[model samples]
Target: MKPICFLLLSTSAVFAADAPKPKPKPEFQYQTEGIQVSLPRADEPKVKAFGPETIKAAAKYLDDGAICWVREKTCVNCHTTGPYLSERPALARQLGMPLEEVLADFVKTVPAEVKPQKETEKDGIKYYGGSWTSIWRSIGLAEWDKHVTGKLSAHTERSLQEMLMRQSADGSFVSYGEVEIPHITTDFELTLQAARAVTAAPAWLSSLKDPELLARVEKMKAWLRNAPPKNDFDRILRLQLAYYMPELVPQPQRDAALSLLSSKQHADGGWCLRDMSALNDWHFKMSDTVVKLISGLPDAASPESDAYMTSFAIVLMRQNNVPVSDERIQRGLAWLKREQRVSGRWWMQSLYRGNYSYITYIATAQAMKALALCDELH
Candidate 1:
């Protein structure tokens, strides 16, 4: 009887040992002030880990890169420098540094690389030959005032003057409009950039005696209202522009756009960038001009619920006055906190190799900006 019992027990132990073990939870880590912070997966209860110090850590890493990128790279596109510039003011404050001190030195180096398309088009001095010089320059000018001193730098002032001079009689700041479609790019990025610029000046647009700039501003508002956004990024930017110029977006349109964006939020409370082929007929056709742009070749990682898009979604909702305590906003914020890595960067893969990581860089910077902004309201 003892021999049989021992044999049975031994066999049971062997079977138990052979059984598979459960997998560990997924995690993301980011180092802050030399301390690494790890975040649990969305499925886990720990996804709600929100921390301001992480923003500080991420900003330090990004600021160092911004300075380096400007010094090493002559061009200043949205993917590289614009995102950094956009966030530096908040970052400067978080770091407890003077605003102008954070910006003045770098601001001096950009004007040369940011010249208008032509040195000689007075009536409609457009700036769109290379995208880096045109729309991004306008974006930088808007962000520059958040930290820089005195009036808009002379070059930015001249650029603004040109942009204002060229405003369409009907009022969309569309100096160039090749890119548009089912909802990722914009037809009036230049217009959005212009609205951003004048808003930073605080009543500068309203103060103008000409009334032409003011009227065009109204027309641009109407264009956004009547035209409706077919692209995702444009929709996002339009939401942002509405924040700066509330009168431009009617309350009903505002509520509808917000609902549209919220509806697109994934089950995990995050956002994903889908392939152009995945869109509806009208959208796919609208996005057809650049099929290669959306095809990520597997490794490029299209249609992933990435930190970049997710961060923008959260920030937009928050900026639009969605309460931080709201479950949707909280879940989205949790998603942002959940996806960041221990390296003080979020992993955002590219769709194309040549220009791929630039988007990643932009994503990282924007992620940092979004988190930092969230911290402000909290």
Candidate 2:
């Protein structure tokens, strides 16, 4: 009876000890709102022909160009062309071919989406800048196409040739707009990107053999050399063009343009596009310094620039071989994560412009690309 009682008491104690503890709460889980990216491993297929030096130089040039725009508080200018040029090498490797084929794919696929905006403010506002559609088409989706083959035809030559055509003796591109544009504005960044696309498609250019187009390209190159680096956007444009057309512009000018941009980098690592326009003009009492001082806007907690600008600046910096560990980079990332819409998208409200799909795509693609670039650099 004593042995039985002891066995029963021991069994009971063992059962109590074996009871499972409550499951610990999970610290991290799958992010439904984050971008779903399964990019191919970079180390699997070894890169050929291009050396680390080339990559480093290209990265530095791109970083300089991007910093220029950030310093100015605008993501236009060099940023317009930055993604195209910066993405070209990676896109080339992704397709396992030369950059020209990717450029051709861009030329073929992008124009279909460029139909004139028939309905405005219905689905979303679509703003028009000369060659803006062309710029967007040339970069975003076209870089991924691997099926493009063959060279430019005589008919295609006309379109490619028009890119170099000078609207005036001065280096600035002429406006199809009724405003009689005299200087390059932030709106023209898309056109700058489109022009870089033409330059990238070397095979197409070689096949076209249009003397007029070649001459015009040379003229634009010459014009950009002396082009004043007034704003961050202008400096970016000049530097981006110089990156591709090194033969046209001297290294000194390029260095100078880059230097101007580096000077503008803010202490927080983010850039501002602070518009100094009179508040009275827009019927507001706030001054430019006050409005430009914040990250996004009054309600936002980070910098004044929109998510689109912040993401783009990050992409540019990563492309130029800048470490993603920079304070500005981290702040920008934090801001991006916070800005994610419930639908897994991000929106950037420009101070003076309406919202649209273009900014949305730019912000999304740029944020994804920045994350990818940072991964590679690390």
Candidate 3:
């Protein structure tokens, strides 16, 4: 018989101290785009799993990651699993849907006569003008409306180059388009996603040497080298850049970043947001963001952190070709196996206000991807 111990985990721990907190946002800014971009602040009366007891909590909470205020919810609301309709395809994969279908369905929302300014907002505001359309164009679906392959492609490529060109005098890339101001904080996470896009764009771009593109890449590299010290997301960007362009970053800095990540594991086996007060903005759940951050840990024994974190460690280890046979990995895997619901899904906390899909898909996808490497490791 499988030993089953049922534990209901709350996503937060009870703060023994009394402090007035702010009201939770009804929805995040991306709601119009149909995505859950942020979570509630800690000032809310939501119950969450804190400490080692998290394994048994029922309602797990997560922190919202947005720095700016928006009119919509998180990414989940905007990008449904329908073909040709969703705005963000990376998010569609989280919903386990066909990317083309998702794009086809979401592009219908774009207004006609897309302009560069309309497509990309100035600050934190949502980009309404065919920005979604432009993203799809990169993936070969740019002409979903009228000119899928013609003017839109040229426009998108030009727009991206322009975005890359306007690097901060200090070398960091600026916001892509018009957006809400002082609202979106450009953190390590955003930079990492940007790097991934920059790294992959060349393969998708018709030509690799777009002069403009190479210059932007160089500037991006410079900004990364000069990024604010102690920013976790910046560390991630640096690590990724080191992986992509080894000669650009010194090897010593690479070791230092990984060492920093490995050493920062809290006693509770989680990474808190940069500012303790930042927790207040995280949607009522802290664990969600914590686990997501755990994905960047560089520790060899990270699997021993906790069940949730360990799961993330296993996923990362397999992804990086690191051995996963550590005793901690076995124990963590065993614990998760026992906790798997009859639906075969691992339920934890949602970082934003939405369905369980966000955290579930990310965690599961990592696990699934790692499991594929198990055969190879054996």
Which prediction has the highest lDDT against the true structure? 1
- Residues 232-292 of candidate 2: C-alpha lDDT, one tens digit per residue: 5555455556555556556676667446545545554445433211222221133353245
Rank order (by TM-score, best first) = 1, 2, 3
Indicate the worst ten consecutive residues by lDDT in candidate 3: 58-67
* TM-score, per-candidate, Cα-based: 0.69, 0.50, 0.48
TM-score computed on alpha carbons, candidate 1:
0.69
Q: What clash pairs does model 1 have?
A: 29-341, 29-342, 30-341, 30-342, 182-230, 183-230, 183-231, 183-232, 184-231, 184-232
Question: Mind giving the per-residue lDDT tens digits that candidate 3 earns over 201-313?
Answer: 43434455767567657666666666664335345345556655566668687777556544544544343223112322321223444434434444423323322344544
Which stretches of candidate 2 lie above 4 Å from their native place? 1-158, 165-171, 176-191, 206-208, 248-269, 275-303, 323-338, 355-358, 376-378
**Leading candidate by TM-score:** 1
lDDT of 1 at 319: 83
Question: What would the per-residue lDDT of candidate 1 be over residues 1-378, giving only the tens digit for each residue?
Answer: 555655666777878867997555433222324343343222323223445655555665566556555544545555556666656655555655423432444445344542333422333543334432444555565566545443555555544555555555456544332232211244455566667766675335656665655665677677756665645555556677778778777677678768877877777877765522243322322333345655534533535576777777777787898877778777777777777655455666543332224455566677766766667423
Instruction: Evaluate all candidate structures by whole-model CA lDDT and list the values in order.
Output: 0.56, 0.42, 0.37
Score candidate 3 by TM-score against the native: 0.48
Q: In angstroms, how far off is 78's CA in candidate 1?
A: 0.8
What lDDT does candidate 3 reach at residue 340? Answer: 41
